[model samples]
Target: MSTRWYPIYQRGGPQLRVFLPNFWLKLVRPTHEQPPNVVQFACSMEMTKYDIQNYLEKIYNIKVIDVRTRIALGETRRVPVKGYIVKDDDTKYAYVTLPRDEKFVFPNLFPENKEAKKDEEATLEQAKQSLSDFMDKNKERPNMPGWFSI
Candidate 1:
């Protein structure tokens, strides 16, 4: 019996299969300005156009009009320690085209949070007070070790 992972589909249910790829896809900012409909992604080197199309359509439920991919050759350099030649892994860049009406913008990963900001400010204040206290204690006697005082 084939087990559907999403809804746990069983007998008499519409059987839908999910493809889990061993590789990973990283959403990357475009090096150059691109149309709003075009989204750039850095994917596994082994991924093909068809694989990328299938992955977006089936997994992300994104309708992809076209997919173009290119491989960027890795740089060859000498290792720091033994000066042995080493080569970095080649990377594949996939440009996925969405429908003209649709546009995608990268979301902001770091947004201001009130609680986090407060915590950061508190930590900064504590650090400043600590430094000032240390300076005051050291001002009484110059060149004295900090461990000498309580």
Candidate 2:
């Protein structure tokens, strides 16, 4: 018998459950120059080198030749008003090395559009010129509101 508080366990019941690891990895842009085959990643502090390698191999399907981890100490600061010390959470960085021939390039998340910029500048210039012309035409009626013009 099954109740709201408890349920009866059966031998052949659905006992299968999906397994998920409590690990997270985020690709980070390298601050300094690094080898082309080396990729930087920010990951959970609890994850080890082996875990990182296995995660990339099994989950991401990326071949990892080696993984090196380092823990960066969080910044400590004192609140100006309360005068209490605060510290940020520590971050774990993983350096994963790929095959000798593999190269990892950091993607440009924000690309500049020269054409769009030129168009925006042209629109702004037109608006400014129209405003100047309107001001010149209304020089005789300086006290009139801008919206009251025909």
Candidate 3:
């Protein structure tokens, strides 16, 4: 049987083994003050307490003292132009407590003066502008080859 589908043990079968778990967890800043050893995470909605514990212990190699989870309601907003109401997907939050001595701080993923994405966007815009200019210049000659002009 696939590792994911292994049935839970009840009638004296060997313990179920979970391999290649597909859960994802994103570290998030806590809106309120918290203990140094406690970290907040936003995770997939389907994860249970056991799943969270296993994910942290197995994937991150972090020893978890305790875990608590709760579902946060998504905000409802009105579409700017369509004047229709929209709601974002609800998310699950996990509060994981580590050993008393271990503390975690969230790192900044995006830094200033890094124009990698901006350069890519600029290139794309330039290509689109060139195509538009070519189309405009070809208005007088429908069948002329692209290389025929300067």
Candidate 4:
């Protein structure tokens, strides 16, 4: 059974099953130092205490001793150009406790400079294509601005 919703039994009904769930959970670095046995996770807002317990127990094969969850408010920011207000989506944070002998540390997703260089190259390649297309389109009108046409 997955985390999808199931119809509730009216009365003396059989159990229901969930076939699919699209929830996402990211293992993030803890903002504050925590005990070795405690692991912090940023999960989908729809997740509940029972869902977390089941996910860890069934998917990760980890035994959870306790679980606590809280919803964190997102920060508000102003758009640089438009000067309009924008708010990020709130996130659900879960602090899961593992067995006494177990411990967890967050892994580094990008550890070296190679990944950043690759991303820069990719962006530059796309920009070069766009510039070439613009120059070709404006070859007959040398002084035309890039945004002259729709």
The model with the greatest lDDT is 2
lDDT order of candidates, best first? 2, 1, 3, 4
- Whole-model Cα lDDT per candidate? 0.87, 0.89, 0.87, 0.86
- Candidate that beats the other on TM-score, 3 or 4, i.e. the better one: 4
**Which RMSD does model 1 reach against the true structure?**
5.8
The regions of model 3 sitting more than 4 angstroms off are 1-19, 108-150
How many clashes would you count in candidate 4? 0
Off by over 4 Å in 4: 1-18, 108-150
TM-score of each: 0.75, 0.75, 0.58, 0.59
Window of ten residues with lowest summed lDDT in model 3: 1-10
- Tens digit of lDDT per residue, candidate 3, span 12-101? 777665466567899899999999999999998889888999888877799999999999999999999999999999999999999999
Q: In order, how many clashes per candidate?
A: 0, 0, 0, 0
Order candidates by TM-score, high to low: 2, 1, 4, 3
For all the candidates, what are their Cα RMSDs to the real structure? 5.8, 5.9, 7.3, 7.5
Residue lDDT tens for model 2, 54-130: 89999889999999999999999999999999999999999999999999999998899999999999999999999
